[model samples]
Target: MIKAKSRPFLKHGKPERRPDLMNLTDSRIIGVYGAQWRGYLQYYLLAHNVWQLNRLQWVMLTSMLKTLAGKHRSTVSKMARTYQATTDTRHGPRVCFQTSVERAGRPPLVTRFGGIPLKRQKKAVLDDRPPAPMAGRRHSSELLARLHCGRCELCEQRADVHVHHISKLADLAASGQPQPQWTQLMVRKRRKTLIVCPTCHDHIHHQQPANTPT
Candidate 1:
């Protein structure tokens, strides 16, 4: 079973230190092994400075070397923690490695079952639909004709309020549910009722008992 080591504690048991040199050096040795296997050690050593690399950079370099050698490469994360001891830091550097091989000629085009060719599909035309009217939806306009916001129980800012419904219009329409008449009655009866915002409306529904009778 794999186990995570506790990071070394600094003053007040805080762990904040760079990775040790042994880990970085091991990664370099693995990188050299990969380079030798790839038959490009001389070229790699001449072109790149492997000795000056950090843990993350070393992992990336080693992974690249393995790829060039046509061998299965270790994951960057695994390479980063290869020589990690119990006193090593947990929050080490993250590395991702990628490689590309040159293709000499055109590759075969094979289609899988149920796959559509890209060129056969037509581009969608713009709908050009007019914007929906918001005259009755405005908070000030809805409150000017109504008495309550229908969400919060507090009575303040009636003019700057909105008429909120307990059930959403889409949900009611989809499920064929009847609109609650108490919402309408509350709006008409109280002249200075609660004026809740959208956030409060959502919060009330979220916090309310889920199984309570509508």
Candidate 2:
């Protein structure tokens, strides 16, 4: 049997200092299915900074400890979509993670499911009649902060303000000039955007411009 020093990730231990947050001193010998898996997880998490993960993301990752690759992909897809998370494939197969919101002051977290068992991804079918180019990229953090202004842009409502991008993503990607930056901070710029409340964002998406509350 291969001996690997796996951290007690699945252990539900109380915080040593506060009611929330685990102690960094906590480490225990746990049985990994094999040495290869143990090494893969350690490298993946360490490279991505596991200490920065939020509660929901950490919970989702721990739940997949013993899952197979196919199940892992399916679960990851569902969870990523639900959480509006980002996905990447740097170390292995594919890892889906979340980004920090500047307004909320939240930390970022990453979850990787790729290993030896991961399968190749399938390609999406292209439409013969593609839609015209529109700026579909997400709004920048700076732009979002400006739009928020402590209230909804359209109705000026104070609750649950959100930013909406006005341009199509394809146009933005095509136009954005590549900038030199750290791998994590790299991004493409969008030309146009709008910041609005949840209601206004939904209205814009539904093509109901007139019904959108001003």
List per-candidate RMSD values in Å.
25.9, 20.1
Best by TM-score: 2
Q: For residues 150-185, could you state the per-residue lDDT of candidate 2 as single tens digits? A: 455456565576655434444423533442221111
Q: Estimate the overall C-alpha local distance difference test score of candidate 2.
A: 0.34
Residue-pair clashes per prediction, in order, are 0, 8
After superposition, candidate 2 runs with Cα above 4 Å error: 1-141, 168-191, 208-214
lDDT tens digits, residue span 9-78, model 1: 1224332222221112122233333332223222223333422323323333443333333221344446
Against the hidden reference, what TM-scores do the models get? 0.16, 0.21
Clashing residue pairs for model 1? none
Model 1 Cα RMSD, Å?
25.9
Error of 2 at 60 (Å): 53
